[model samples]
Target: MRAVRPGSARDRPATPTVPGLLAARASADPSGVALTVHDIGSLTFEEWARRSDAAALGLIDRGLRPGDRVGLVFGENEWIDYAIAYCAAQKAGGVAVPLPAALPAGELRRLLAHSSAACLVHGEGRNPPHTGLWTATLAELRPGAGSLDDVRVRPGDAAQILYTSGTTGEPKGVVASHANLTFGCTADPRRRPLAHSRHFLHAFPIGTNAAQTMLVNALDARPGALTLPRFTAARFARLIEAYRVGTVFVVPSMAIELLNAGVREKYDLSSVLLLGSTAAALAPSVAMALTAAFPRATIVNYYTSTEAAPAQTTMVFDPARPDSVGRPASGGSLMISDGEGPVPPGTPGEVWLRSPAEPRGYDRDGDAPGKVFRDGWVRMGDIGHLDEDGYLYLLDRESDIVKSGAFKISTLRVEAALHEHPAVADVAVFGVPHPVMGSAVAAAVVRRSEVSTVELRAFLTGRLAGHELPTRWLVLPSLPKNTAGKVLKRELRTLLATPEGDDAAHSS
Candidate 1:
């Protein structure tokens, strides 16, 4: 593994705002395809720029002012309109809040209220949850003839506010500045991360950090972003085969599904050069499987959170160190601390990342004690350690560490071990309530073939310690996941509390 080359100032975006990135790309390559929604349509950089500029004028006509918050609600299929709305808000000098359409009405209401969004722009066929907030459809925001010269949007100005997945608790709104979003963007296509690729494919849903990153890539990278209206393993595979896509990005769940469905066998995916997995650590077993599936592709795992984005760690799959998430990339700094200070190598502690870009924070959590953001570092809320090679190995989320009868267990380790079993297609290891102990390790497993608790326990005998082995087992058809393809552990805990879950399986 080689050290990530730090980007120089000359490599930074010439115009450091989201709107500016689009403007630069349009001017440089007006006729080049910018975004292509497979089976739907494609938009050139010039078209995207002109459409967004016109939408910005419409937003201003609709009473949007500098610093006004505009909530953007769109379906997965509405990425074209979503992109325009996202840029229009910034171009009109308003902060954009991209809300997932999958969210319940009440949850949407809560987010809109929290962000204090003055207006909401939604896509076709999407009903804006009755929030009483001023609303308009993308089409209704009629294009107007005017320039956005009056609005003074600076790189330091707030650009967007995205909420967390709320897997552990209430979703917190993460606010990012223009500089934060456009940190590594460049006018020179050669400097882009995936410049070697003509097109990169991803199916990350709208309102996700992954999707937002793809949007930025559409503007900054030489590759035209290719995606589906919605992601299905079959459709994703077909897109790659059809486009001969070189770069591909997916979350661990999507990768697991693709592997489970055996899409590689059906499609010619040999054209893929880079396979990036993000949102969560890719299980080593899954990563190795991908290497075989995409023979020439470099399987990379990216680690970052909604609260700490752009600042991330990228690991090019190294069989010798499969468990390591990797050292910090893109000039970011990482440290493992135990509350008081930095911990020694090989000692697990809270992981923190410091980025050269402007730090993002909870929208309303200003200087609150015990908050994730401290100084310039964003606490990753994950337990990990740095090896002598400076590679980060994640143990588990601090909240996911199972405590049973004085023993602390890393669920990630348990899950990783379980993933090695041929019968186990996917697994989620979490803590379940225990009367004797504070909590016991429990696993919700999705199997590729029927495998009893006895067989699984036998397989895990030497792979995991006694305390780390799950006492309770639950067989599932599929794991509950959020829009971003992250497992909803809280939902798993809720399911485990049910009587049906109690009778699923148990081994003591």
Candidate 2:
């Protein structure tokens, strides 16, 4: 193992800080391109570093000081500017908070109030009504006229606050430090796979955890990063060809869409060397499809929550163990607990994670007082088990698991089995109320062709046992998804609960 260098010497560079890292990159390769968004042009390492520094100075001039919160409201085309602002905030010694422009007014108000943000920054031609908060556009924050010194930010200082996507409940801000954001960047380059890719491609929105991670990877990894304003399977495939992109990042939903649409067949995806999926578990069938699509690429599925980031489990796809989400990576430890304490091996329970980089807690949330964080371990609220070899297998979110009759069913397992059907395009399995059985398994499916409920059941016969099968299936034109491509189970349940055929007419 390579020893991590200490920062005790005065001559050594200030690293691990977002601005410090970018400065180092620019110093190493001034002329190399750093970021490229097709519609918004590109930025070389030198240009990005210089402009970001000026942005820091501009923020400082605007009265941003240490520990102040600055919220960035960004559109698709504003990513480059957003990246600059992200570094600038930290450089100016302020905490940066990213707010998705698509958020509802009420949600936006809640987040701003929760983070105690001092200013809101918007992009070109965009103006979101402010609820008693200072607001500015990117165009107004021009580069400074002269040289400016970088702030000395400590490793443990507040870096960024990432809001959860609210799949399980209300959105909460996750507080990360400078150390949390820069955990893996100091690893030996010779042993890093990120160094192999000449270019990285992704379409994650600016405010997302996945996107923020990609931003750091672009700076720490090899070559440049390219992005698309909007993502469609066809557009994603086209970008791969246009840029000869060698590293690909996507959610499992997009992978299924690409497979169902046969988009890869239309383009030359041979340049892709690494494909990664996060946010949710990648179904085994989808993992196999990605393998076949990018024959030379290493397929990786990473498991982590917005709260448990920086500490995660990573697995390169093994066809034999496709159900596993890999073992815990460095800088983290994993344990399965059943309230009292650690559970026996092979027994399913809440997944607890311990890492040096785990978030302190949710900011200003009333629901945080609980057993979630105990003895420095974050109870992930996810239910999973470990095999004899220590490979972790995620079943489902504890709240998402279905109790039917005398058994508990994992929605993830059912969804994974359904994905194996050739005609199934997308699927979300959940539990709906059943008077007799306590709860029954239900599924919402999107089909590529004319697939009847009977046909799907027949296809799933040997793949799943009787109790694990989804008893109630609703075939819809498409499953409702959020910006991150996670299925809106609450909306699905509401749709199914209604007696009106208006919604049912659209479903089979």
Candidate 3:
């Protein structure tokens, strides 16, 4: 409800435990504003540490023991409170599980049951019906009369359990250790891009992987972290000018919206020195547009997944190789393999990466044996290739690649080509059932203005091969997107299956 700006509080902690990190920050600069949720309120380092400490006491008071899982059900309004609960869980030697607030009731119930969560801590009015789990509000996690004892936590101890987005299948919980959660916490702030910014801006939802990364960036990278519970193109642009945001983190979808909204022309974004896009591949066209919008800023496209973090690719947009997602980061290794062994240079295959920060594996209840994890490497489930120089270039999700009669087409390549058209605002290329071809290329296009499918196909003639062009097309005002800004291709397939929208599909 209120915004408070505190003076410089410079305290850096070198602890590996989540609570130890907070304790160090609080001790260094207790009055520093650590987290800010737009239109809500903020928490100073001291306030965050104290409240979380009390919450830890409460967890202990409620019989939470080491390795116990505590599920968190909070939305944007409860970010600060969620942070407190997160630390409290770690301090009490418990594992914190952040549940997506937008999940359906059935899915939520399933996740809680699957996670074996001992206690559920939620925001005000955000609690769900429980058959057996203990439930409490963030405010209810109060300290008892007795002094709270510090629970010892090891670097190898499990600190958090993050569920996958389940785009391909059921969501599996990935267990991260304290060392994984605390990676880069002790890095020199003066050298990092975020350290120079007074305010860092991001709009990732609370329970997603990107949001967790932003939370760490808040504690280590920048002085204050600003967030938008809901994302809108205009609002995000204005926030930069309003707060003079120096560092920003976004996904490809948000970047596209900003370019299309033309908000950069309406706002003074000169304060922004660094803009980073992640969680999905950055379309080359969108990358170019970002560079134009923030001429004075360094635009970076980072490539990483929840299962393979710390080991990531960071690219500072070069015109020569705009599509490349950069090389393997320091102390990390990446390779492309075709199930048997490493593939030749420039061959597309599953992207496998090994990073010290990677989780040991998924929860025992989840599948991690030989499919996702094998030979000490995490299969990214992404289709990509490495250049002769070893830079990674992501094509598309292996699941979304279109398969025609005799050819496999990279949907991302087609989508990227479509984006180059002036009349096309957005596009998603996928596969659909065909009478003869078994599967044919189908595209869902969002145009800037009324345009005929015939005209669009003619435009892409030179850019894509004849077979790569869409045989079926649907022109919609916008593509269906999830909370994380990823297009829901499954829904698109379902939409095409219905005859009601059949008339909208145009053939080349």
Number of backbone-clashing residue pairs for each candidate, in the order shown: 0, 0, 1
Cα displacement (angstroms), candidate 3, residue 47, comes to 0.6
Q: Residue 24 of candidate 2: its Cα lDDT?
A: 79
Give all TM-scores, in the order shown. 0.96, 0.93, 0.94
Task: Give the candidate number with the greatest lDDT.
Answer: 1
Give the per-residue Cα lDDT of candidate 3 at 163: 88
Candidate 2 TM-score versus the reference = 0.93
Better of 1 and 3 by lDDT: 1
lDDT of 3 by residue, 1-508 (tens): 1111110112223436677777777887789899888899988999988888889988898889888999988887678888889888888889999987888878887888888899899889864865378889978887776345657777767888888888777788878777777766764445544666888999988778898888777666546889877889999999999999899899998898888898878999998999999988788888998888998899999888877776788888998998899987767789899987799889989998877453446775544336666544678988899999999998878888877788888898999999888888888889988888778888899988778999889989999999899888988878998777888888788887888768777777
Please give, for residues 1-508, the per-residue lDDT of candidate 2 as tens digits: 1111112122213337777678878887788888888877888878888777877777777777788999888987778888888887888888899988898888888898889998887787886876798777755776555335546787767789889898888888877777778776753445444676778999998788899998888778875889989988998999998888889999988888888878767989999999999988899999999999988889999988777777789999998899999888886888998877888889999998766552445666633345565545677888999999999999999988999989989999999988888888999998888889998888888988888887787777898889877777777888888878889998878777876523552322
Q: What's the CA error at residue 88 for candidate 3, in Å?
A: 1.1
Per-residue lDDT tens digits for candidate 1, residues 1-508, read 1111111122233448899888988898999998999877888989899888888999998888899999999887788888988998999999999999888899899899999999999988877668988899878887566668788888878889998888888888888888888988887766877876889999998888999989998988888999998888998999899999999999999999899989978999988999999999988999999999999999999999988888999999999999999999989999999887799999988999988787787787453564577766888989999999899999999989998998989999999899999899999999989999989888999989989988898899988788888888888889998898888888888888888777775756
lDDT of each: 0.87, 0.81, 0.82
Which residue pairs come into collision in candidate 2?
Answer: none
- Which regions of candidate 1 are displaced past 4 Å? 1-15, 143-146
RMSD of 1: 3.9
